[model samples]
Target: MPSVLWVSLFMWSYQKLASVYPRERPLLLLRVSGEVVEVDEKLSDLPGLVNTSPYEKGWLIKVKLSNSGELNSLMDDDKYSKFCEGNH
Candidate 1:
């Protein structure tokens, strides 16, 4: 059931939001901001922001890295750029 529940990010996110609103609390640590920050609570009301204004008005959450070491595991601009180009 755990694996089955791991569906699309939209589904998973909506489910999480139902139980725990992202705007009410910190979802995760950014590893760059170095602080715990809240998501744009408004995202719950307007999920379309994801497709409309993904960069600016549609931002999901904010965080500061609690551990900079974890930064290495995430995609950087170049890697993400290549990934987008290759996949799409």
Candidate 2:
């Protein structure tokens, strides 16, 4: 069944991750096991941090970016404002 296939894939992925990453740390330490983890150690107690500083200090993950150039497509504030203005 579809559910069985998904569960199998999930289990296989977890095992693969466990092997790839050191399991000495708790599996959910950062809600993941890896070399690069962004930790907002204060978020749980102050959930508004997500709204106040989403892209800056409040980021939930700190990934080792694979392609920095992908950011070129993102609009700057003026462009984003214009785009949003047109939508409303």
List per-prediction Cα lDDT, in the order shown: 0.45, 0.38
Residue pairs with backbone atoms closer than 3 Å in model 2 (clashes): none
The TM-score between candidate 2 and the true structure equals 0.43
> Please, what are the lDDT tens digits per residue for candidate 2 over residues 54-81?
5554444354434445334445456656
lDDT by residue (26-80, candidate 1, tens digit) is 2432223245355566767776775577666666655445555544555554665
Off by over 4 Å in 2: 1-36, 54-56
Best by lDDT: 1
Clash totals for all candidate models = 7, 0
TM-score of each: 0.48, 0.43
- When summed lDDT is taken over every stretch of 10 residues in candidate 2, the lowest stretch is 1-10
